[model samples]
Target: MRTTRRWWVPAVAVAVIAAVLPVTPATAQPVSAGPGPVVADGVTQPVFGYADAIRERIFVTSDVDTDADGALDVVAMDIIRPRASEQGLRVPVVMDASPYFSTVCRGNDSECKADLDGDGLNDRWPLFYDNYFVPRGYAVILLDMIGTNNSTGCPVTGGRADNISAPTGIDWLNGRRKGVDAEGNEVVADWHNGRTGMIGKSYDGTLANAAAATGVDGLTTIVPISAISNWYDYSRSNGLVTRANNYSGSLANNVTNPDRRQYCAPVRTQLGQGGDDATGDYNDFWAERDYLPHAGQVKASVFVVHGINDDNVRADHFSKWWYALAEQNVTRKLWLTGTGHIDPFDFRRAEWVRTLHRWFDFWLHGIDNGIMREPAVDVERLPDVWETHADWPLPGSRPTQVFLRPGTDGGPGGLSVRSGPGNRSATFRDTPTMSQATAIRHPSDSSANTENRLVFLSAPLTAPLHISGTPIVRIKASVDGTDTSFAGLLVDYGTRERFSTSGDGIQTRSTEDCWGEAATFGGYAEEGCYRQTVKTVASNPQELVTKGVVDGLNLDSLFVSTPLVPGAKYGVDVPLMPEDYVFETGHQIGVVLLGSYSGYSSRAKQTRSQITVHFDSTRITLPVVGGRQAAVAAGLG
Candidate 1:
């Protein structure tokens, strides 16, 4: 690493360069050196050459030992900006602090290789931010987050150390924190205006959410796509463990320095102990990582984008975060899609880039782009169509509870408003080996009539039924065992083909699609093209809408567990996955109840105990457009 002091270029030299440079859509006009700011049109600007305008360096953070070592950690920072910045033109910063730079790469690439050039910098930068934003008068910084790549320390997953590390970088840019280069020399950021915006996908985006939640002074806004708001929710649900392995310790070890893994053994042990897989209850460790609790501290505007059908992070994360931000009156916008675990770059390239440009300009550059005046929510209704609303769940939508009733004869149950016989009940044996697909299949299927699950169906809809928010399943049930896992699925039963947002649906290809102003550099592959079609392999007759799970011991609270007493009935409310979807006319809405879901949780020993649900006391509440009237018109009331 190398260090340098603040340096400035002569005003006269910049003026001469501006006079000779050409002005075109494909090339940036030279900016004159002056004390005042020069605003570049974010929509149209040339792609600046990386070699001419970019500089790479390392910034050793102030005294905060993430690895429990005596010394502080160093973060790798790579910057790209307009060359005119050296001539006194200050600009706002757009940053992405990520750990994947070394472990998994940023975009479609599966693995990231450490291909360093002679200058001790990565030859290829991840993502399109550097390729597109530098010419538009924004400083783009690619930081190898605190414990990965060239940064010194051990990764702690989403612990307090990891949650606060990225925000410290914002403090450094605002001149509040001290930083130095790799050679034990002082380094300073003299060119930035101290206003920053962060953006990324998945874990990279989670860092942005965490940093913004800190209420860091200079952070203007954040864009978190398919990001996690709580680590415990990502790995567990209501006392039910989703993963068998210890994720916190495993991920920490994966991102730590190869040679220093043994040195961080104690930290890994601490992570495993804090996770507490046996109970899966919320603790201080998860609370520190829960950004929702800290939303009140956020001053930065939030622009959220998430796939409604994303099972990995789940829509609950974004929905809960959005509601919390609303309570704090934080500026916010949302784009909900029908895709899963995907970035907007791959889902809708051209529109996303244009929207993002305007968003950054309005928040970071003080440009009135009318982005704030527009509708607050834009949701994908189907495969490629979109609908804009004043806010999420629509203004007129109401929560309507649809009751579950036993079949007239010896058939499956029905979803209706009328109550069934008081003595009617459905029983199923706890089977930990049943897959989600088998559990939710239509009751007519011979394979679905097993003793492991109970299926209920609604009559064919007379009109289209649209639901736009989280659905809750309220049930009165008794079990023979002390504790058992409960899984509930809301499904659509029809023959029409739909976008496959589930993980098992699609097989992406090696093809690409071109968008935006074309770039002719590096074989025309820089920011010009992305995957054309997120290929869909449709399922016939039935498709899963959303699912939820809970442990009987957690019926009262997620933070505390109380084992159920055998033969005692309990009323439990299980929140199904949040969704924005429409069931076409003639299609039926179905609900499936199972004892356990092997896909989302570890396979426990077979309980072989009977679980009985009282039909008259069980119901599901959905967010419908016109409440019971709409449901009645659709033959569901």
Candidate 2:
């Protein structure tokens, strides 16, 4: 039920395959035994030259006139392929179509696309994709998103204009769309085999999601790292606007800065209205930007990489998308880490590049590398330690409900497998002035300042308890006023060292390592080398596993608003953020309920509204790794 629309067509018009891949001669290292690029082991070799790769600039037309210029928009594309493609070698494409190429830089190093000669062709490419992949017989295209950097139109975050930018270029590569050069001369991807794989981080990755969702033919695979699939989930959650006013417009403006977005002033204003910050409801405006409902349209295989601790894009985006993809029987893979909004190339460097190379070879070049035969998921649960699984949520993972009980002698309540006494209930006054941390932590303080929240804890775990998926907290509560919000935090109460979401959770090492090939422009050597990073860790008494907050009016549905009556209980189902965390032995599970969570929302107008909870009717259903027996064995009962 995650998706209601069927947007994917069963059959797409794919390009005809005519050419057969050539094999390289064996040398000191292992070479190709069959078709496709030369492989030493499972990965393709850097046989094609990069320093003299065929680099050119072109434009592809797209639908919509975002700038109100009365003409269809054109996206600026910069292509880099192996010079061997100029001969008779037909190579696959790897594209990083990005909106950040102009206004903002990407990754920890803050790198951006550079055009030294101002001729639309890039003098320097961001990241190491070009240096690494071009030599491996793949073409890496750096696309300037519509309305930014030599492209025409306005950038409206996840709207149609922004989503189709990459797909149109894919169409051009497949000879289905018109493309022109710097002098307006027609240009066709004559050397391309019509197999394309999109990869990027953040907004760039977001475009990859958009492209795959369009069911665009010839797009064989996508590696979306820390990307957003639903814009509504990005800015709003269950009728609560999580971001500032006009977030879509502000984000659009930021990505197209330095006067490129000048003529798109009116378009920006319209985008602000489309967000509907005041009501925070799902409407047609949000529908155009949401890719979740259209998840069935995905035809390409997905290799999803996301930070489990990424609050910017949130983990729910990937989890929900994965669920939808699973329902559609889409081939997929997952990589979950303990870092923030960062690319795996920076953290997991060696493995990521190697795995990614094999992935592209298998999908784009049809190399039959047996990547799909491997485990479907790689999870980094304990800091640097990693484990592989058949799929996410684990095979034995199932829903386990835990009841929230009241304190016996006016202390903290308990979490039990059996339902608590129906007669008892807890109440907390709305406190917008208090921080979310103060509301959830320090339950033993006995201070009146913390009375604005209710805390529930379970007995210390005797065994490791794994919470592998999304946790739903269904509460029957009554608020004194209609303008109140509620929040719940799933906590791991134990003193230990863990990865913190603060910063990038890394320290820059002195040694620098290079990826792919080096380049020089105007005697300046761009060695493609980068300083390595080590994951940072922090020790704390407790770690916040996941959180969920909701506006009191959105008890039933996100699109519908129902006002809460005074002293009338209503069922409020709050789904916490998706998480893959393990509570070790001796650690306790904690849940905190607060009014007006100040850390996420600012709509707690008066902060005087008090909430009354019904203990018997409220329960948290967690997707536990081993189901009910696992909870009881961990001492929850």
Quote the lDDT for 583 in model 1.
92
> Model 1 RMSD to the real structure?
8.2
CA error at residue 81 for candidate 2, angstroms: 0.5
Taking the tens digit of each residue's C-alpha lDDT, what string does model 1 give over 265-343? 7888888888888788888878887889999998777889998878788889898888788777777788998888888
lDDT of 2 by residue, 25-106 (tens): 1111232232345777766798888878878888988987888878999998989888887666778899999988867876
lDDT of 2 at 92: 87
Count clashing residue pairs per candidate. Answer: 0, 1
Give all TM-scores, in the order shown: 0.89, 0.93
RMSD of each: 8.2, 5.2
lDDT, candidate 2, at 370 = 66
Among all windows of 10 consecutive residues in model 2, the one with the lowest summed lDDT is: 7-16
Alpha-carbon lDDT of model 2: 0.81
Report, for every candidate in turn, its global Cα lDDT versus the true structure.
Answer: 0.74, 0.81
